[model samples]
Target: MQPTKRFDAIIVGARCAGAAAAMLMARQGMRVLALERGAYGSDTLSTHALMRGAVLLLARWGVLQRLVEAGTPAIRRVTFHYGAEAIPVDLSPGDGVDALYAPRRALLDSALVDAAWEAGAEIRHHHTVTALRHDQTGRVAGVVALDEAGREHAIAADLVVGADGAGSAVARLAGANVQEEAGHAATCLFGYFRGLPDTGTHWHYAPGAGAGRIPTNAGRHVVFVSVPQARFKAELRGDRLAALRRMLREDFPDLAETLGDARPDGELLAFAGRKGFLRQAAGPGWALIGDAGYFKDPITAHGITDALRDAALLADVATEGTPAAFVRFATRRDDLSLPLFRVTDEIAGYAWTLEEAKALHLKLNGAMKREFAALTAEVVS
Candidate 1:
């Protein structure tokens, strides 16, 4: 087929990773196009916590400042409770910078898309990629997409980035074997709370197998409970929200009580996926970023941070004379993601234990506080 069209890059999925990647490349003078199935300013049931490291990356992108001005605030400390014992980690205010800042996902993602658009990357919203086209040599040369009106169209590019998130079609198209780890059927229930008990926007890690609350801006908080598939079924039986709400009251009363007063400000969210990965993050002319590559349990609240990191590294590596930029991007991702894998693995193991839970909770609480402080200061989450 003739070259459909050409540009420096065509980005699929305009969330944080895609938008940031598009922005970075565009700022460097490349013509970039970003396609997002989701609307620019819509809300999502996302666990929008950014670790300190991810927080720092956002600052460099210029959107961080906008978020702050929009009333997004820093979250300094994380507290843990196990067996009536409380472990509070000091997330002191910015000694000049706070390590972590919390914002709603709608606001966060919208800001990112706006930044990409402002940087000169054209965005096609409500467009869904239907298929990917590979050249005879097997490089991803273009994508076949359906716009909001369902018209099929082809767009070619030097590179096609798949930031389409967990259920990424690009990863599959690139021959990356996506697999869910065995025995990893962890079901999650989460949502934002508007009115909570006088809880100081501090993340709360409760006693039990696993229960927690992450605070965010504008009186928004994310509360969730992770349970085995069997337990999840047993608890929900159908009324998942009721089961989840009951879980909070009984197993994590402190958080439950706070949320009990909380009005559901957004959709109640559910996450049912293995802490999974794509065996290969790229091939030929294509690459995967963010949740499209490595996605772990929300237990560590690493989603946003990981997305920012993925975007930053992609900017430097996915550039000129690099046929292997995609591979390099994947490699850099592996290097960064491996540690996170280990950390999440440990957290998962510890979360399943009732006896060792307290010690592990305290240890993690301390780490989160420090990390959170560092995040607000634009250090790293």
Candidate 2:
């Protein structure tokens, strides 16, 4: 059926990247539609840590205050543990950002969705895209989606954005190629806990394992462990929680001691590990953002930040509504993303010794600094 209504752009996912893009575009007075497959404000598996760049964007877009008002803890300092030596860094006030945060996905994604809706974007929750519709010229012009009631609707738009995630259906439908993929992957097992001491963010690194304790909303901390995928599969078998506990006791004994009697608030979650990739960013009337375009292992915990960064970049050009502008968006996105991607891949490899891991982290820090600088200059200017 032909679409009875049209939009300037239709976003395939309404999480971080898609919702942020829709909000930006709609704020600029473009007609936007965002389709989400999940229930409104539903939670998803995520480390959910926001880097400085992401915080800057959220602040600029007027969404950070909502997160703050929702009682998300402010992360003012971060400690790096290298074989029992702790190096704590206090975040100084700069770039209009005083502190960082780790809001739950339920809160962060819903906040962006609400912001988009308030900015005049049409948001459809529990809507799954079934197929892509193309114009006669073979460029993606719209999509056909199944609503919550199982009714199908064809929607026309000038562009279709793939922000569904690493397993993005829109990217697959659009034949977005995998441009680059990491050779190594790490499995991450994490869970939330209450009553743990809130000490900002703590990252512990040993020879071949990594763990972190991140403070989030409701006075809970997310503690996670990352190990080589092969070891996780061969050693852990089906008992992830036990393995996580053992690792915490053996590799991160200090953190385990701090855990004291703080039992898990929820079930343990696992990302079994998949090779991270950078996919084709844009082609014709379809474009990819967030994990749909570039995904790295959760070991780095920079996924959401990258998603917000690319969403802004894509929206800046996508509003122009032309193929050349999309190409420009891709180029700019790559210029900003490639360095951090390389460092993250190396860290995710889990092939480093304690000293090597420290060096890699330094490199990662440098990359993040450069990213923050670039985003501040461009977005704030």
Candidate 3:
């Protein structure tokens, strides 16, 4: 069936990466369509932490102030606890970014979708892409999606971008193979609590276990604990809240004390983790971004940041509208992502000692620094 309408690009997910890509591409005068399988402004499971690179990109795109106005707390310092020792790092202001934020996914994703809409990208929420449409040359040219009413629509575009996340239908249909996969994964359980004292961001680490507290919207702090996936399946069954409490009390007693009488505001959430992967980033006429293309363990809390960064990178090259440009986009993304990926995989293993974890964090920090530098250069040039 022939498409009734055509666009320069059709983005499969309109959350972070897809909306940002649509906004940037629309800003460059391309006709863009962004489709979301979920309702607009809906929330997803997330750590809700944004690193400096993400903050910088949001600022550059003129959306950071919206988050600030919406009451997301500014994170200026982060305390890393290795066993009994605590190391505090003050985020230095530079390149027009003073602080980072941890906005709820509902807010952040909505903000980006709003930005895309304002930039003239057509956003269709509640639309699920069912398959890719290829031209006579056998290159992807559009998508067949089902609307909320279960009506099917065929929409054509010059490019189809899969921002649909880890289990991306676009990746599957396009046969975007996994180029690399991590051997380790970690399971996490988290909940939000009100009345927890504001503590910028706190990361607690003990042998084979980790926990953290991040202040977010509505006077709430998201507190979480992570353990090896094997341990989570084998030992942390039955009462999940009890298991979380036990993990926090044993590995992060101070955070447990900080919780005090402040009970969780919502049901506890769990991420039954999967091994991270680097998928084939771009194909003939389809490209992948965000967790659709590259995913690392959430233990590092950098997924949102990586998504925003790649959105900018892909948008920059996508204007060229050539397969080779997409290749370059993939290459540049891998250059900045591989180190962080390796370090995050190791940390997710939960096989490191206190000293070893600290060293791994240092390596992670160095990789983040390089990513920041690359983004800075992109902004400059």
Q: Show how many residue pairs clash in every candidate, following the order shown.
A: 16, 0, 0
- Deviation from truth (RMSD, Å), model 2: 1.2
Q: For model 3, what is the alpha-carbon lDDT of residue 131?
A: 94
Off by over 4 Å in 1: 1-4, 92-96, 178-183, 197-208, 238-241, 349-351, 358-381
lDDT of each: 0.70, 0.90, 0.92
lDDT of 3 by residue, 1-381 (tens): 668699999999999999999999999999999999999999999979999899989998999999999999999999999988999999899988898889999999999999999999999999999999999999999999999999999999999999999999999999999999999989999988899888699999999998999999999999999999777887577876778888888888988888876778767889999899999989899999999999999999999999998899899888798878988899998999999999999999999999999999999999999999999987411
CA lDDT for candidate 1:
0.70
What TM-score would every model get versus the actual structure?
0.87, 0.98, 0.98
Worst-scoring 10-residue span by lDDT in model 1: 372-381
lDDT of 2 by residue, 1-381 (tens): 768589999999999889999999898889999999999899998978999999999999999999999999999999999988999999999989999999999999999999999999999999999899999999999999999999999999999999998999999999999888888889988889888888899999987889999999998999898899877886576666677788889899988788765778767888889888999999999999999999988888999999999999888887677778888888888887888888888998878988898899899989899989989888421
Alpha-carbon deviation at 89 in model 3, angstroms: 1.0
